[model samples]
Target: MASPAIHIPHGPARSAHLLQRTTAEWRERGEDLLLFAYGSLIWRPEFEYAEALPARVLGYHRALRMRSSVNRGSTHQPGLVLALLPGGSCRGLVYRVPRAIGEEALPQLWAREMPNGVYDPRWLHCDTPSGRLRALAFTLSRRSPNWTGPLHEPELLHIFRHAEGRYGTTLDYLLRTVQGLREHGIRDMELERQAHLAARHGLCAPP
Candidate 1:
């Protein structure tokens, strides 16, 4: 089946501008930085890191609640992506970036993550097996236009079944995230359940 055409947003320029301003502010502090990867970053960080460790973030849960209008779905038939929803905890990876390379890395990270400024990147406390740390995390601001709160099963399933975009199908993103989490010894019950349903119903797209 043919997917609907999508209008890619042009907010990446704004994101780049914000990155310059924000990273400069961060640089003023003169400290090492850490990034918490809960979704795609768990597998495709696309950046250099000095070290990585298993980490748990409190007070936020990973939800398949972001609307992807370009990468994983079209504007006409938007798909669901993972977002850091409030009220629970998430187990993921924390990447430590050395201060020497912070400038080069932060802008690149922002360009990838804040393309449309749908996320609010903030520093949140993390509990790692090694120790405690405050790490930068891209979280969904409920007020963002891309936030999809509390979708019904039928709608979500439909998205998983058909939505496709630049990256791939929605189902592929879901499956990959599940695989990435498992490799890190973390099993997200909600994602696992949804994945089971997807597999059982043959929601995956053809290669």
Candidate 2:
């Protein structure tokens, strides 16, 4: 069964405050900090973690509908990156960071994901093979200027063709995500379909 939709309210200081609050809470409890990852974090966590396991978060699903002009695209032509939007569920990986390392990781994570303070850092309950646990997950705020609710085919095609940023091209991001999911035994049909579309149109190589 599918999960219900969620409405996440955020303020100007939400991202910063939430990041600090969560880290402090974890430190106070003296437990491992868990992070729910459904995108690049699944493949390139770029942080040290004590453990990682297959996990699923309800009330949200992954979609490459978030506008990115930095890591995966540019100002002239934007690219799409994954965002955990309301509805359904998402299957990915949950990383467990030790208390000592989490302090160092939190700031770096905040810088990477909250460059514009667009994402809402939420504590979500994730179901894992081991058990259910609460983890920090970055979620999308539909009201954010960076949110690309939807895009026309032509606009998307243009992005796939010309969107390249400091990290890499939008096409590369899509293909890599598709590959990452497969590598983890997690299949996202929609992402796979998009990859095929990009390849068919010569926007990228075959997935």
Top candidate, metric lDDT: 2
Residue range with the least summed lDDT across 10 consecutive positions in model 1: 1-10
lDDT of 1 at 68: 87
TM-score on alpha carbons, each prediction: 0.87, 0.89
Q: Give one digit per residue, the lDDT tens place, for model 2 in 68-102.
A: 87778877887878999988999999999987898
What is residue 6's positional error in candidate 2, in angstroms? 16
Query: Which regions of candidate 1 fall more than 4 Å away from where they truly are?
Result: 1-10, 205-207
Task: Give the whole-model CA lDDT for all candidates, comma-separated.
Answer: 0.79, 0.83
Clashing pairs in 1: none
Please provide, for model 1 over 5-118, each residue's C-alpha lDDT reduced to its tens digit, 9 standing for 90 to 100. Answer: 123343775566556656765677687768889998998888788899999999888989899887788989898788887678999999998887777888777766676766
lDDT of 2 at 111: 72
What is the overall TM-score of model 1 with all chains considered together? 0.87
